[model samples]
Target: MKPAHSEFPAPPAQLDHDNCRGVASILSRVGDKWSVLVIMMLFNGPKRFNEIKRLIGSISQRMLTLTLRGLERDGLVTRTVFPTIPPRVDYELTDLGRGLSKPVIALGTWAMDHMEQIEAARAHFDQRNDTA
Candidate 1:
């Protein structure tokens, strides 16, 4: 018979120093609040710079510009410039970016679903701590 824990999946491969550093670096970039918000904004389709800023509401123009440039540099987004009396620029997700969107959206959905429960838990913890 198989061992009791045999049904469980094996753990992931161990990361060497270099691999760990690389993973950490990438996570620091992609895991930031701004980056996640930007990715979600582009998940549906392309949007103009102003449109994205408007959609996200509180993001400053400079921060939005920096976020777009960083995403473009990382190959998760593309910027297109249209020739017109007034120049137009659009940002769209690359295939690699779309791959990231599925997990990000699921995470966002999970957070939204559990927010009430999470808040209640925090309140309970605080109340208990205060009484102690």
Candidate 2:
């Protein structure tokens, strides 16, 4: 007799067009350079807006604001405001955001480990393309 697992056909690996578009949109949000950096910075703990900006060092205030807003909208981040003379605001990863950390970190680790190979591949491709 066939195995029980063989009773069902294997699922398609590729998403249908509509599903693909939806996934692509989410990937674009998460895969953007600034989002990755922001997420990584928050992985340590909560941080104020300026702290995130200072650590990232090159993002504009507008861009940072947009990024944080997007993350908060997506339910990946939480923003808290404190009562004070000037008021203090902080951003932290929510459970959903923390869930994203592992995959993001793995992507970063893989990039770091293979960057040399990627650069070599790029150089080889460029040299070949230049000859052509």
Off by over 4 Å in 1: 1-11
Which pairs, if any, clash in model 1? Answer: none
Clashes of each: 0, 0
Model 2 error, position 120 (Å): 1.2
Q: Per-residue lDDT tens digits of candidate 1, residues 11-90?
A: 65887899889988878878888888899999999999988999889999999999999999999999999998699999
Residue 8 CA error for candidate 1 (Å)?
9.9
Tell how far residue 79 is off in model 1, in angstroms: 0.8
Off by over 4 Å in 2: 1-14
What tens digits encode model 2's per-residue C-alpha lDDT throughout 1-132? Answer: 956798667877877999989988899989999989899999989999999999999999999999999999988899999999799999999999999987898898899999999999999999999999
Give the candidate number with the greatest lDDT.
2
lDDT of candidate model 1 versus the reference = 0.90
